[model samples]
Target: MWDHCPLMLMRKNFVSFHVNLVFFQVEDAQGREATIQRLADSIAGPFVYSVMTLSAITFGFWYYFGSHIFPDVLLNDIAGSEGDPLLLSLKLAVDVLVVSCPCALGLATPTAILVGTSLGARQGLLIRGGDVLERLASVDHVMLDKTGTLTEGKPAVSAIMSLACEELEILQIAAAVEKTASHPIAHAIISKAESLNLSIPVTRGQLAEPGSGTMAEVNGLLVAVGKLKWVQERFQQKTDLSDLTTLEQSVMHKSLQDSQSSNHSTTVVFVGREGEGVIGAISISDKLREDAECTIRSLQHKGIETILLSGDREEAVATLAKTVGIKDKFVNASLTPQQKSAAISGLQALGHRVAMVGDGINDAPSLALADVGIALQVEGQETAASNAASIVLLGNRLSQVLDALDLARATMAKVHQNLSWAVAYNVVAIPIAAGVLLPNSDFAMTPSLSGIQELSGYGTQKVTSVDLVKLEMTDFDVILGMDWLYSAMPQSTAEIELSSFSSQMSLF
Candidate 1:
């Protein structure tokens, strides 16, 4: 009895297992079919309307005109008695008119550009429009100089050593006077003060001398901060004839001459009290960004040739470029804005699309000349460059350059996809329109021609719709504009996410 009971339980368990397997198999098969059906429906939904509209227009023309008017026109007496030479000519003219290129030249190029620009914007790269974006993407060689493009434009006080007074006190007084000035040097001074946690006194009155420094009233003291010569001159005017020793007079006189020559090259800050002598001097230097080397390598990895053009001395430019691992090409030693422009034009004349990245007033001309001009966000001439440039990188980080390049490449790929679709559609449709596959073919124009006509119209209409979506994404309502996103994320992640989002939005 026990043996029989065990056998019955085993048989019951086997039957239950078999029943569950059958149920699951049925459910799995149904789920798979449902998935396939959903996919088909989703794809067919948009295309159905496209095909229907195209078919209606094509058939309407063929039935109302092709069947009624065209054959009659072909057989008319005006056709020279159904075979006259003049009538044949007239018929040919009509056929030619009907087949005249429907692809509007004015509309096609602009539409492509509109699509490309929208795609670029979605990738966190704000391109002005079609003309500029096309030109930028086509660029081959890029010339990027180290200084401001690959370095922080703000030159900090690297080593503020005091010659006469307390170093911190000198920085504090200078920062106070500079608080009222708008020069880069002034900003560097204030930044240094803040870093040192020194409290700078509020300025009462301030006056800036172009190419020199500034003079101001801080905490009820007449503080003059400028080149040594200017400060010495101010002190000389206020002091008596014998206030200074012979050595002091000689040093002051020599400093003034040197100041005049060095004014264009170096920035020197001299701080002193009213009717008194010089206290201390602070020298600041612009340092390259920490990631400049890595950024250059990233560009090289993408097969883009990097070159540097700078107004700085040749030795300095070479040193900087080499430090950043970009030593193959560099033009140095104080190039004028026109010279920079000429260099860009010359490179472009060689059939290379040149991209110039710069951050100075002198760089504006070159930026305009280059195929694609990129300006760093903190650059002093960012506004002018941004207006002229095809792209603008908004951040102090040099690595942002790599991000911009990746975005450009991806945007170009999307443009290529669009171009390919346009060409492929034409290749397949033109032969059918010419009636190439007509006689003795069951698979005739009735189905495929209708499909072609519908597809073309559908594509054209969808382009317009997609363009609107792109415009909304690119031209989103915001003050800071597209830069906010690029500023917030790493260049790589931002670009990848942007590309994915754009592709999805375009339904590519």
Candidate 2:
């Protein structure tokens, strides 16, 4: 927690003479709902109050004076009995004040948002605010990064092409230099070296180039492990592998031995030494998520354009795109974070709302730039993607994206319903309370009746239709949600549940 963020105690729990307290505050939060409600209150508050006062005065004068002037038309048993004109006027004026409540207009949105956000929190969805929810509901194009998103983010070493160098030596140096990198491919190389029981050397002054690779000093020698072009530039050598020597005895280099059965999806990186030039190439492969294709299908079925963004080989990205049902034209490969952000901006410029989803540092810029950013939560890793994103999925399930879309849609629906009802009630209730129906139907609203109806609307909003329903227990759960869960946007597409982080402006 930052020094500025002081926790405001909400509640405390007891266990074995120990106290565990949970502290969270969502009031006065700055988001779509809060902004809209404040705006609505500023204008609607005075407007309703002024209108009520004016209407009361108008009705009061008409009853007190007009009753005597036109007894046959005004003096009726509908509202007030034949009594002192001042007393009769006072009762009707008070009725006008009671009927014109600011709740239906002001309270509608905030209340709905509160319920929606709280429900999302309990379900493991940390939605940032009503603004993120509104934007998520409007996203027509979903841009998903390949690693840790479309794929499992668990790459494994498949082949190593050493040029006149021992395979184990190449792997050892590659793993040693790549040890400082956090990328899944780096993990793959290091894990392979460890499985082979190779003694890995420590490196210092590591420089990581996003979407390219890493370079470091290993035992006084500057070695580079990444893309061929980048590694060649770091080694000051030529980027050419066509003039490589024969490798006829290797079984792991099946792509070279039997070209017919080669895996095209494998990502290959060059390993180079300070003076040895390009020494070898390490090939790695990560499998696509089991739900990747289905999740893409679901988005497509709901009329969302699923686009693939990756910093991998074009062929690999295109192949994954084909498998996941995203069109070839929508696939962006070998792109850095800036390029990814440009891709999002381009789509946004074209008036298409884009939602970027990823789980790496490279995806952070695009995630924050998109209309809504969705990030997957890796249990142990504190990812930059999670920090920048507006929505974070706790589990490694692709379908959670759709679940989030569903939640956004559902939450907005509740907001619209509340606002609509509030507007309609004000429109009808105010007119009737002003004695608009007294002339023809002999019906007039009383102060007590106006108060009852206004209070009923609020009472009805307190409970959900499925409130207090029983469900079987599966696992232990504890949750806290504050005022959130509201949006006024049109939600006709898919939505999901997500929780937000620092963007929430809880003053505690």
Candidate 3:
């Protein structure tokens, strides 16, 4: 019996602590692996290795050929006793080593990433590191999770079709039963009741079935609020509910046809009691983010393929895809977490680099599997979705994702520019240190040649860092200057309320 009930077994065996400890250890390992993976993917690591290899080759080549190729340059500079061919060769090799400075290569990617992420943060986009930016720049496909990525994730009561009682009365009973439930649908019903200032009856002996519905005793009667099938299963065990089932089919059909008013996808929850039959049905809908369509179109315009994946009903998912301008072939519906991960893997198998965007726990696995995972920020510390993601959007708007993509591309372009300059500097300076340009170059000592190369590397470092800072500072000044120009515009009340509510949730 204890084995069947894990909670009971935990209390009896004292093994729960060990289990939890092991679970945490796995989580820690995953975090460390993700960090290490990002560091390995960064541009600086490869540049360092390349520069070191080239430096070694430069040393060997100059050491062997200094006497033959630069006989004029070396003989003129040799001192009395230490001026042998071998010593002069050694001196040229040392100059070559010092001139091939890796300082510029070391600082190139990291500085650009720092400036880019700081700018991104100011605009509510959180770039995890240079690796994520690098991935973002090359991603050709984007997999968007429907619920919180495209839709608001907040369900609202769209319609109330009451059969056996007044709509208000049915809502009061349903809200009372759902008050103790933590589901999003439950919260929507409760919020509707509160907004109407309805007085709810007391509830007792409440029980909630995850992903299905909730049941509770209200006004001395067992009131259930859930899917039609779950309610029918519970009610049919005690009494016949054929009439209620027929009524539910009618209500559901009606709700589906009324998609114009409800918009997007809507879920119907049956409210009823045993023996008394079905009383009413509540139609709840999740609204699409106001900018979702525009954002999708923008991504499409950039030639990036956009795909929608959701666990929602197929019809609803199709409707959303159509509304957002995504092709029918690219929309996938009714996928489990494992299926979502498989879809990402399949895309990658086809040679497409995928970026997964989501904001829920169900998305965590797919987020981890994608080449780049971007979590839409909800008001919280850190979600499992965010932990698995390489990029996170701190703002609620879908448009912010576009901003992040643009910033990442720009940052990468800057990184390439810095690296090109660094490589070119080494190419030209190493040969000079090897005495190729020594006949025409006005360098009296080996120290002077190395000093010029070191100064050039230091100058490149200062220029790269300073240029980014100036660019970001200039953007800030422009925004501050234009604040008054936009201040007189009226704001949407709905958007204002939603933004404030989102901000408040983030604080906690």
Best by TM-score: 2
- Model 1 per-residue lDDT at 368: 80
For model 1, how does the per-residue alpha-carbon lDDT over 1-508 read when each residue is reduced to its tens digit?
4655533433455434533443343223222222222333454455445434544454445434443444443343333554343433333333322332233211234334444444444343445444454555566677875546666666666445444568788899899888966556677889989987998888877887643567888778788877556677766534333433332344334444444332112234567777566766666556567677787787778777878876544545666677788764454545656667888888888888888887654566788888878766552233565556656654445665565565445444544554445445545654454333322231223333344463454355335423433332223214335444434333332234345445645753
Local distance difference test scores for all models: 0.54, 0.69, 0.69
C-alpha RMSD (angstroms) for model 3: 11.4
Q: How good is model 3 by TM-score?
A: 0.69
Going through the candidates in order, what is the number of backbone clashes in each? 1, 20, 0
Query: How many clashing residue pairs are found in candidate 2?
Result: 20
Ranking by lDDT: 3, 2, 1
**Per-residue lDDT of candidate 2, residues 1-508 (tens digit):** 6769767876633321111110022222223464456666776768776866767675666566655764543455533465455555565677777877676667666655665554554444557777777788778999999988888888778777788589898899999988878888899999999999999998899888888888888889998888766777886666355643232123235544434333234577878888878788777767778778899999999999988888886877887789888998888898878899999999999999999999888888999999999988654345888779887765556777887787677666666676667677777877777666665776766678888877765544433211211212111132212112222111211122111211221211
Task: Count backbone overlaps in model 1.
Answer: 1
Off by over 4 Å in 2: 1-39, 64-81, 244-265, 462-508
Models ranked on TM-score: 2, 3, 1
Clashes of 3: 0
